[model samples]
Target: MNLADTIAAVATPPGDGAVAMVRVSGRRARAIAAATFRPSAGKPLQPRRFTHGFVVDAATGTVVDEVVAAWLPAPRTYTREPTLEVTCHGGRAATAAVLQAILRAGARLAEPGEFTLRAFLNGRIDLAQAEAVRDAVSAPSADAVAMAVAQANGSLSRVIREVRDPLADLGARLEGSLDFADDGVPELDRGTARAVLEAAATRVDALLATAGPGRVRRHGLRVVLAGMTNAGKSTLFNALLGSDRAITSDEAGTTRDAIEEILPVGAAAIVLVDTAGWRPPGEMPVGEAERLSGARTDASIPLADVVVHVVDGTAPHHATAGRERIAALAPGGAMLEVWTRADLHRGLHAGNQVAPGDQFRVSAITGEGIQALRSSLHARAVAGSRGAGSDSGGELLTNARHVDALRRAREAIDRAMAVVAGAMPDDLLAADLRAAVAACSEVTGEMIGDDVLERVFRTFCIGK
Candidate 1:
């Protein structure tokens, strides 16, 4: 973790592949590479351009592996420090040998996220950008990747800094008024201060609105299928996923555990879960497995972002009770009613007893209404994102820490607005504005604490 030491690590993921890379960063990166690597053409290694080379054991001068090395000098590299990357033939022996040779040449193994921490320390990137690197690497869906890329490109940092700028300016003006009392500088009136603070609060509100959808898109929405035994939850799950992911059977209580799958609905991803059939504890003539299955189904309801309560269209009332139970346990506005076996319905409107407008009627057997249901799910997922009401295309705040920081900034601005409205002293308004600026700075890492930085970078994988 020492900032001054040269660090090296295998940048590519573990295991055999077409190629692998070893990354080295710090002041001694170039020197270590020069010691362990020899150019194929017997020419001196140049900066920024790749050179075909052989990685050699420093102690014995034995060629370890064939590699292509690139040396990048400080102030323009990723860490704003001297960096070297060696791409070698993919395999455990070759890559590991090359890395060992680099280590023997005076480079220490890098700690988790050390490269990115160095980038942040050297001012090549800020806190938000550092976080974005992790997000981009671990993104589970396309939407998540897009959001991460935007933040990595400084979208979030720019937004935070820009919002803080006006507040900082207001604080400077208030200080000027206080210091130049005898010079007759016009002091900021409560009305003007309130107006400025309110405008800033509105911007914060806009950013905060993206937190929910950002989280949903980042981690994906948990959509669980729950209903009475033999209600076709497994069938519906398989139908939605377009594969036989879950075991479907005609017998009741066949599904004994929750089967989870990642299903992309438009740009958003849904963590679709198929839970065991719901049954009253005493009503089921079952063993320990069935009891546990019921308990799991019950437990999954509350955690789901959207619970698709499936009921048999042939016996809609039988599922009504289960639907009500799930709705009670699920988060508000998170339940979607689905009536299965729509193909078997024979009565008016295909034996659809429930009101036609409120629920989605689907038939797993015939694939009827499946695509419509997917489209509806996709639309609902999109609505959960920040730009639901407009085409603003603003950056969504995906990080929980960033959202919390924005909330704090918004609260500070609110306090300043309230103080101004109360005709409080200009110094009090300035203090609140300063607090707001500090909160915003946390997002950009301007005034961040050591503990926060440690926690942020620790989540990153080693060799990042």
Candidate 2:
């Protein structure tokens, strides 16, 4: 927490704009800026003041750029250290010059996520709030921004505290019960402990449920469209995107690669991908066109969070020998059987079984069942998040790490619960409870070490 090294970075997004921000944070932040900063007005780097200045090099003293430096002196700033943010002319060269001058004046380049990490270490924010800062910065939509802002302001930290507080108290009491057992007094009643554990477990479950929705707000959904070429796949893509992104042609196999676009589906943007149509298994794929198309289609299938299998309404199901093929190649995903070109098959329709084991529908042209399809898609992607919708009806694990930790925790807790029920001894119950607590701690990084932090941050881009 005693960081003498000042960290600086261009905080604004990299681009040409009217203005950009260069941020500096740490104990020596003001001094580092003073080395290169030539302020023209206001109380000079005082406790609180914004000064107009021409940032310059310390040695030769050449001007870098005109900037507004506002000082938020020690312990009362982000990172709980003295901080200075310079608003400079927006451009690659001007922004770079200001930051370079700060660096030349002795500020170290901040590592990706270092500023937030420093904030965490200095107690200005918790891990969750620190993470919320990143989410808030990278928010794509207004809703996500609002949610991230709420979280950064400590909504999730409060919820986490509400759930984690009792557990911590229970843990302390349990430890006390063991330590002072011979004193003839119990710190926590057995029944009360059971009730408290159950309540904590229930709260964890609710939080786990909300995690999906939270991630959805952070990352948009993935919706992929697949079927035989000329099944009106491009038309459907055009309809959803409200633009002609993919070329429409009557020729079969017109599309040979995956085409993805963001479509506004309710409050969230769903990434819709139109893949190369599913081809017959051994159709003597004679050229690069055939091979690449098939490969891309196969690759796209596994990548889909949800699949919309387009079935040509005008074609006989058995003629192309594909109804069974499409069913067999269901891609292990949330699928919707779509009967495309429904306008051409109104009277002749005999209620198709296009998606034998999934929901089937009709239309690409003439808008024959698009609304129903929209509703189905909406049901699949809840509020702009990735993965499956809410009704997937299973405690579907969200984070792979959480899933692994909770699986271990569940087993440990179950063992402890059994032992507490007198099915096993108290000593065994206590040990199992400790193990469960350790497992739960993993999810919150309580049991994590420096190596894990290194691994986590290494995956992040620098200057985060």
Candidate 3:
């Protein structure tokens, strides 16, 4: 935690690879590098350029590993401190030995996310950008990667500032009017102040609107396939995934547990879950295995964002009962009714049945209506992530912390607008505006506390 002390850590992942990196930062970084590394050309280390060298023990002069090292001077480095990076042949022992030599020469191991924390503390990047770095590193899909990269480049920060700056200027005006009223300074105009407050609130609302899609993009949509036994759930699951991940059979209760796979659809991913078929308990004498399978299906159905209720195309009588069961299980989730074995249905009577939601007739064996179902799933995924009022294509409020902060800011702004409408004192108006500004500052890390910093950075891996 001490900024004056030098820190070092293995920056690469712990595994065997072609190469690994050890990073050092602080005033003593260059000194530690010099003590442990000897340049192959026998020259002093130069700034910003990689030099071939050998890392050795200072006491025994025994070689540890051959490396390519770089020295970066203060004021231009990631932490705005003198920095050193060494690339060595990769393996657990070689990477550990290089880091150990640096530690022996005088460098403490960095705490989790300490490197990015230093970058924030040194004014190289804001708090939002720091969080974005973690998101980019751990993104699950290509779309997620692009979104995280945009956020790290300050897309969200720019949006916050755009909404915050005008309110700040208005607050300053209010303060000036209160402090210098006797010196003939102009009093604030209530109408203009109200307009500004309203505009700022609108912008904050727009940001909040993105939170739903942002969450869906960050964590994929959960879509569960539920149906009666032998209703072709496993076959359709394989057809959707384009692979035989689930065991399909004519036997009832073949799937005893939920099987899950991820299907990428446009800018979002669908977590497709195939649950065990449900059978009414009293209709047939049930065994313990059948009870467990039904329990798992019940558990998975309620948690899904979309529950696909599969019905056998040949059995027209079971459709009403299936719909009732699905409604009872997933009352709040979106429902899609699918009739399997379209190839076997010779007439339109079964397919024309009235359904509450979307209905699709699909034949997993013949590939009939599969593409249409896939398209529907993709549309639902994209609709959930749409950036409603935002002009920035992919910029969204993905983190819950960010959404909460913005909500607080919007509430504060709403209070300020009410104070203006009531013709309240300038001091009261200024206080609310200041509160709004502080809330926005918290998002960018300009006015955050140590506890919040610890919570945010602790999620990051060490040497970040």
Candidate 4:
């Protein structure tokens, strides 16, 4: 919380990799680097230049780790402060050594998101953009990354300012009319006030409409695979993943639990769950194990964005049972009928009687219809993410905090509009507009409190 003290942290993720970096920010950042870093090239640390160095202990004069250190001076850095980044060999020991040297040189360890928080406080980026940085780091798919990048680039903030500036103007007009009555200033008429507030509301509604798709983009879809036992669900799951993640056997009740993994289909990431096969609790030969698996599969049905009902194409009886099970288990989720083992269907008719679409047949052994099934899943996932009225150029509200603030802002604006329409007093209408302005300010960090800021930045990882 103390901006005056220099803070240091490992910028790269903790683990072994090709490279790791330690970041330091504050007035003393460059000085701390100078004390701990001895340039291998025998030169002093230069601004905005990477210098090869060996991090040395200040007191013992012992070499710590070989590194490349850079000094970014104040007013041009991420925090708009003197910042130092030390690139060392990737591993916990190397990063720790550099960080410890920084601490010995008087830089304290940074908390989670402290770097980004400093950027926000220093006016380099607003709060919405700060959240976008977090979103980009955790984005599961390319579409999510795109939305996050747009927000980080100030798309959402631009939209907020577009709406908030007009309301601020409306408030200023009301205040000026009230304060400058003797100066012959014109009052803001009810008609003009209503128009301005209504326009702002329309813009807010436009942003709010994207919250659904934005949420879906931020958090990928959950797709569950459900069907009766020995329906070749595991084989199909393995085929989709292109790896033998699930254990496939000739046994009927081998998969007694849900195996979950992420399958990136085009721009959408699907959290695919391969649940245990369905069976009546009392009828299951394996008793409790099968019963528990069935329960888990049923529980996952409601949580899925898309529930795929997989049935053996060779067995016509499974079609009816699969349909009944999907309808009874997952009433609200989108359902897809996938008939497996098409290569072994030796019957006269090739298509399923219940669902006779080309999209319904899939043979795990022969790899038939697998690509089509994947495409269908991708299409459905895209539809779930792209809400009504969503366009490529339009900005999206990806952060929940922003959405909540915008909703509150819209509610306040609605109240202000109603107040203006009722021929209310100028000060009363101004009060509602002020409330709306405050709510809007929270989204952009203009009028947010410390508590909200703490909650927002806490979701970020250390070193941002």
* Top candidate by lDDT: 3
Candidate 3, superposed: residue stretches over 4 Å from native = 228-261, 274-303, 310-322, 325-332, 338-372, 390-394
Each candidate structure's TM-score, on Cα atoms with residue i matched to residue i, is 0.89, 0.82, 0.84, 0.89
Worst 10 residues of 2 by lDDT: 389-398
- The lDDT per prediction is 0.84, 0.68, 0.87, 0.84
Runs of candidate 2 with Cα error greater than 4 angstroms are 1-4, 46-48, 187-189, 211-214, 243-259, 280-284, 287-296, 299-303, 313-333, 337-380, 383-404, 459-461
Stronger candidate by lDDT (3 vs 4) = 3
Tens digits of per-residue lDDT for model 3, 1-464? 88788999998999999999999999999889879999999987999999998999977889999999999999898888899999998999999999999999999999999999999999999999999999988775677778888888899999899889999999999999999999999999999998999889888887888887787777667789998888889999999999999999998888998989989887678889998887743455168988888888888888888889888788766677777787888776688888899999853233343453488889987899899999999898878766776443346899999999999999999899889989888999999999999999999999999999999999999989
TM-score of 4: 0.89
TM-score of 3: 0.84
lDDT computed for candidate 4: 0.84
lDDT ranking, best first: 3, 4, 1, 2
Count: clashes, candidate 3: 0
Model 3, global lDDT: 0.87
What would the TM-score be for candidate 2 when compared with the true structure? Answer: 0.82
Indicate whether candidate 2 or candidate 3 has the larger TM-score. Answer: 3
lDDT (tens digit, per residue) of candidate 2 on 99-132 = 9889988788888878777776777776556666
Clash count in backbone of candidate 1: 0
